[model samples]
Target: MSFEDKESPIEVDVQSLDEPIDIKAEKKLIHKFDYRLVPFFCVSYFFSSLDRSNIGNAKVAGMATDLNMTDAQFSNIASVLYATYIPFMVPGVWFMRRFARPKYYLGTMIIAWSLVTIFTIFVKSYGAMIVVRLLIGLCEGSYLSCMSVIATDYYFPHELARRSAYYFVASSFSGSFGGLIATGITAIKSGKLESWKYLYLIEGLLSLAAGIWVFIFFPDSPHVLTVTETEKKIQADRDRRKAVYMGDTKFSKPELWSALDWRLAVSIVIQFCQDICLYGFSTFLPVILKSGLGFNKMEAQYLTVPIYFLAGGLYLVQAEISDRLRKRGPVLMFGTSIAIIGYIILLAVKSSAVKYFACYLICFTLYLGTGLNEIWLASNTAPAFKRGTSISLNLSLGNVAGAVSPQVYRDAPDYTLGHAFTLGCLVVCLFAVALQSWGYKQKNKLHQEILESGVDNRTKSRKHGDDDPSFKFLT
Candidate 1:
């Protein structure tokens, strides 16, 4: 069979391999895709984040008291939401990629969680809260990881980080926005429901609207559509920069058996470390400032706005630079280094002014390691199943931190132990990143030797993804 006949359903059309440049057309297509899709992803992710972290907003707005939750029970409320997150990551990606278009599946999932967020208004007890949280997890599973894959369809590999940064920024914006909304929501004295319930009802309605918008308007990737000659050429050309691994439509037993290994474990560790930093900061920062640093409730809420803005802004700058340099390792190292410094300041400093600055530093680097790391793994892996599996594994394992980090607040007030623990996770993550970079260099050398032996194996190896000598590693 010819290569085109055997390629995965989602891959770039082999027919376009030799197509001449169409700089103007490519730019138009990209801008069109960005205009059409990025906003949907941005808004969807913003709602996802607002709902996910709004509990932090709600907790401070008095959900705990309204529901009679103890500190431990409150922590459990945070943790229980991820009860299904880990188990569903891989399957979620696999299922969405196989059966659902990116737009429809994600829109549906967002609406599901938005409704779950609304259900929080009815929680009069801790048991009710736990059930609601667990249901939320089932709705949210693998959405972020799937977003990573969908981005590859819309952007070239080098462009993925900047686009991903937008989604990341939406989350940061959501954090800050959540705080602002909570500040207002808490000031209300005349509401029928509690202040926190208002926070949910409003955010939930907006989220549901965004979901419906995407479901109505989001289009399938152009590569998958061939209704017209002009459209096919435009899309096929766009694929010049698209990820070569579009993934298979479904999983097979052999692919599954061969995909798991130590590298996947390491990727998961890297993800786990990043999430410790993410959930550690995103989930608890406002509360930490209030309880530990002694800011008044509203004072703490408004203060979070600038911190999240700074972080989101900083990530956009970093994403642009990473895409320009095309260097994942250096960016990952630099980001982690900055984050490590932030943790150190939080650990060692006596000045609250400097400590607040350190919080910005942590939020700033939140997207650095994890966002680029997703691009890094996606660029290197191939044969859609392996890529999906590895990304899902990394996300699923890493997200356990989202559940666990909230409870680490056991060291409340000072929170010295929690910060230290997160610091340690980042350090390990950096080491893992370095090892992968080094391993890439070594593998490239071996591929070089094989090429020099006069074996024409490049085309034969496309089925192996990055393992193909024709495919070079980003490292």
Candidate 2:
């Protein structure tokens, strides 16, 4: 029985020292953490998401025509961002894991991407667009990974879903907010810059502000912020119970390999399935509405506002349900089912207004795939490096869809292939969820039996983090 820290391995009976923790004060401290951390991260993510997706709005605002680009070249612009993004995630998470303070790293990356967003104003050709998007992708690749690390470090398993949802809700809000901003930008008559250029400039500045705020204010650890000895003890106890090696920067080979568990493997497949639709539908929705659905450009720009808001609102409800039930499978399946119906209507129906209605149905699965799947993975995985690797691998592999998505939707006007492809992905995701749910339940039951039989001392020693009999996976 060992808590695998390279610097100093620990073995302790957690129940023996649990009597001194004050439940009420612990609650107060957790509440304080929630307010101080969640809001700032949410706002930061809002800008990150806005910068990431606003290219869609810019495309409809005439970026392609202004750059003299063909449809194929423009589709490449949508995808080239992931060229660097996918490769950088694992290293980024490794950096965060080894660093004592990840806030500075995270903040600096945000600022870097924000600057790239501002630089999009100078993109006068297809190659320039690709360069800017590539730079942005490099800078933003690890943001969500860093945030996932921070969340796992600070919160309990049960709390991860709701907190993860908060960041994603901000992500969801960014789409709507950016749409509103783009709509307003279209109102300006100034010849100095195109409406698309203005979208980049304004959102970049906003994101820069958030980056600075996080750099200046985000805490390195709960211990650094807690004032009282009782609060500090509570933090220590919390970490002990979580089996996290607080402040330890050493990486373990075992934990790294443990990250390749079957659960993570299955989760990655599900992530790939969902992200195909998430990246495809989200980045292309504006174009889909304008080019395929026959809406005017301005109409396409603003219509995304309400649809994204619908996504955010529904995610909040789903997050609440997930936290309450302590289950990820049901909510995920439900979202996919509804989105399946949405894609059906989009493909089967001929009416423009009815197709518009189908977009709302598709929005139901938005956060479930990206945010909720992240929560499931983060909550289930354990030990700092292991969790970090699991998350990074899931994201890096899953987001290859960012590149694939643009190609699928190239058919335009009808986009029958794109709609059918995404629908098939949803069906795959449905079965994956069932398989993962069954796996978690079986593992939980096995752990329970091991704990009851007292055959292994790992529970008392808290060995192997989440693999210990005492630790239960969040299904």
Candidate 3:
């Protein structure tokens, strides 16, 4: 059924393929894509991150006490979203891969999750909170996978790290600015709702507005992008070189096997290790600042701004480095090493002031490793289905750490166990990075030997995606 679809053909204008690429037109069209897509994605994701983690903000604002919840129950609230999110991610990506209009599909997802966030305002009991969170997980589990695929639709492999960074950094934006937003909401004198309730109400409405705008304006696919005929031709020429084939939605069994190789296994391991930190530390950052570091409530809410912003800024820097070097593993290795030092400080340092500084070091690789890892997998994988499958698998299995992390951080003020465990996970991530690097090097070597023997690998790559010996993995 996937292959039989007329729309799935890799159609390019024949005449345009013959013409020399219009460099100026290409630049203009890329710029057009940047403006049209990036802002909407960044805003949509900003709220998504905020809604997912704002329970911490709400907890600090007295939601736990008001609802008469225990620490173990609060921990369950943190972990339960992943119970649904992890299982649903693969199917979500499948639905997105088959969906003709991604804008409509994604807009519905955004609207669904935002409605759940608004409903969070009325959760007066633990049961209500768990239900709403589970609903949100179901709605949002596929989001990252869908967005990553949508990115490949418009950008080239080399350009993906920087572009992905643009939206992915919005998680940090939510952490930094969400604190201010939450703090501001607390100041409002609303007799009808608690401060935490206002936090959900305001953030949810803003996300809803963004969803409506996306449904009305976002492009369905690159085919529907508003660009000149000359630009379209240039795009076709570029598509021939892409890891992901534009307009070809068919699932190839060969590509599936290729996607399940050792490289993907290593990538999955790295993602899981990286996410342990992402979910554990990023979600509980406000709590760490308030309870762990002896900061007062308001200070904790506001202090997260600089730390989160610094992390976002640093991830962008590393992304530029990764793009320029055209290497993912080296960047991953470098950033992870720095964060290892940070974690060491966090574990060993006794001074509160020094530990606070160590938090900044930890933030260095917080977003960098996870975001770049996705870009690496996307760039290295082939065809739409394979890329989607690999990403879904990577995220779904990897995000099980999200379920584990909240439990590790069960002890609030003295998070020694959490710090040590996260540091250990970073060590595991480094080992996985080494394995990926070695695996890519060995495969590329074998491909080189095959090419030297005059093998017809390009034809295979063209037909079967990354199975060709001539196609090099982006190491």
Measured against the true structure, the TM-scores of the candidates, in listed sequence, are 0.91, 0.93, 0.92
For candidate 1, what is the TM-score? 0.91
Off by over 4 Å in 3: 1-19, 188-190, 243-248, 455-463
Off by over 4 Å in 2: 1-17, 244-249, 456-463
Question: Would you give me the overall lDDT of model 1?
Answer: 0.76
Q: Write the per-residue lDDT of candidate 2 for residues 158-184, one digit (tens) a residue.
A: 677778888888888898888888788
> What are the RMSD figures for all models against the true structure?
3.7, 3.7, 3.6
Error of 3 at 99 (Å): 3.4
RMSD of 2: 3.7
**lDDT digits (tens) for residues 1-475 of candidate 3:** 1311111112234365456666687778888888888887888888778889898888777788889998788889899999989998888877766654778878888898999998888899999999998998988888877787778778766778888888878889898878888677657666789888988898889888878877788887665774677766766666654523333557766656767877788899999999999888888888887888888888888888898999899888889989888788998999899889988987787787888898898887899988899888877776667777888899898999988988988887868888888999999999999888888778688778877997655553444445556557778
Rank by lDDT, descending?
2, 3, 1
Clashes of each: 1, 0, 0
TM-score of 2: 0.93
Query: Which pairs in model 3 have colliding backbones?
Result: none
Candidate 1, residue 29: lDDT: 68
